[model samples]
Target: MSLDYLVAQPVLEAERFILRPVRKSDTGLISHYASDERVARMTTSIAHPLPPGAVDAFVARAMAEDRSEDVWVIDGTREGGAELKGIIGLKRMDRNQSEVGYWVAPPFWNTGLASDALQLLVGSNPLKNDTMFASVFQDNPASARVLTHCGFKYLGDAESFSVARDATVPTWTYSRKL
Candidate 1:
């Protein structure tokens, strides 16, 4: 259950969806989902026109984590050969802490798939288990709601953020005790 042999993860079956890992083959899906201005706006680090090879670079980076962190948490719709639905990940995982970040294709909105994936990750066979942090956009109530629904409690705000939209986009901190 270490998944250490896996240089990259495949689809993870959840009660309602698949939480896979990003792959080089998934660049098309990445481009498709990242193309939308709204979705792109939610996480603007994904370049507006998403410069070519960006997804590959992202996958490369995800694979470079300390083998203890599940850097890429990509979601799909079914058991196999599923259309990539979104991406959720725990960045900068320490022995007992990590940052949760994610985005869903607008088509799959309001389905609770993101929450399901998160639950699956938390319940997955991983050793670095403990409290996890979520830095959500202050303006994205939907994300805040999802975090709350998944048992993450409000922990105030932080100016530090990975994908900051602007100086006004203060990040709200949340934590779920494991």
Candidate 2:
């Protein structure tokens, strides 16, 4: 990947938080939340007992000019909330499509932050994608609801490898036409 073909990530705003590109300063907070077993086990990535410097590497990739995915920190400092409430991203795919992924800090769970962030990202559609896709482990229905609430329809049941769980977990796939 090269800078010439990179698409600049845009800052998106919401009533409670703003979605902005990840920065070096976010490493600490991201590490703190992602380190939680409750948070790590739900996603396909983010290994449990996070390896040394994992967050640093993740942040570096996010800031890379030629990265395939666009990641944003769900910042809430504007509303006097936590500066890093969570993280969200869209991984580009062929055919003007992308895969959406996100996770909220355990402390912020049930606070509607995830839902707001998802809605904001979809509404912005920064990648100008024709469609978007997402999948959630069957055990995490909360995430599935967040997607459905934002207009993603259930596509089918599937499985994905979870780095944290170290197993192939059942997942529910969904997609929304833009």
Candidate 3:
């Protein structure tokens, strides 16, 4: 899609969650979820113990880079008010091959927040029909299931460099053919 088109759009919503842009105030809440061992262990990007104020820094970057990452302030709409429950985004958005990635708070896990937001993240947007890919760590079953629920086909294993954790992580590739 064109740059102007993406910028003009507004927040996306699913049945139970709202995917709005991230604000500076969302740092604390992001850190809370991102810091979880269960949450961090699964993803190759996040560092263990989730460095202090790391989430704030990430949010700041997201706001600055409109072309690369469009973050969402995930709120549980069906359950209650706009209390920040998690964050989702179209990270690594290569117009030729964009990717969907997200994290929900531990308290909100097993409730379909990730899947719902993921659907919103890649569904019928500027690049929904195009080929989209996701690299999930082998150990994270929840993440694997999320990809499966989103209709992503298993494309086997691949290796990628993760700057956040400073390692070459093993990632299984999942793809949705548009």
Candidate 4:
């Protein structure tokens, strides 16, 4: 997509959740869910025992006009779902590609929220991306399932530093041609 087209981020809707841009009011819930060690350790960015103001800073980045990534909160209020079940985002890469990432609050695990959210985002192709990439820590089979269910083919194995784990973790890389 062209720069002009990419500038305006859109709110995505699924049957059970609404993928909307982050708002100032969401900081508390973001901090609440992300602060959990279980939630933070599974991903690359969120740190365990989340430092003060981390959510605020993340919110600011997500809301930035020139941000390279487009983030959406998995808001389920419309369907009487949890206000914040998780978050999903796409970081723009070269050649009409984007990297997808997401995490689900523990309360919503095994409830198909993650899978639904993944399908919603992949189906929308909100960034108008020609390709989408993703990676999941090898230990997180559910995440890998979500990606494969959405048609992402395994690319290779790699390692990424986890801020929460404080160690480099093995990851399985996957990609999909949109």
Best candidate according to TM-score: 2
Clashing pairs in 4: none
Worst 10 residues of 1 by lDDT: 160-169
- State the lDDT of candidate 1 residue by residue for 44-149, as single tens digits: 3665656778777776776654544465554554555357778877765667677777888888889777777777767662435588888766777898888888
* Candidate 2 lDDT score relative to the true structure: 0.94
Tell me each candidate's RMSD, in Å, in order.
3.3, 2.2, 3.5, 2.9
* Candidate with best lDDT: 2
Rank ordering of all candidates by TM-score, starting from the highest: 2, 4, 3, 1
Score candidate 1 by lDDT: 0.69
User: Could you give the candidate ranking by lDDT, starting with the highest?
Assistant: 2, 4, 3, 1
lDDT of 4 by residue, 25-102 (tens): 999999999999999999999999899989999998988888899999999999888888999999999999999999
Give all candidates' CA lDDT scores: 0.69, 0.94, 0.73, 0.91
TM-score of each: 0.81, 0.96, 0.82, 0.95
Please identify model 4 stretches exceeding 4 Å from their true place: 1-7
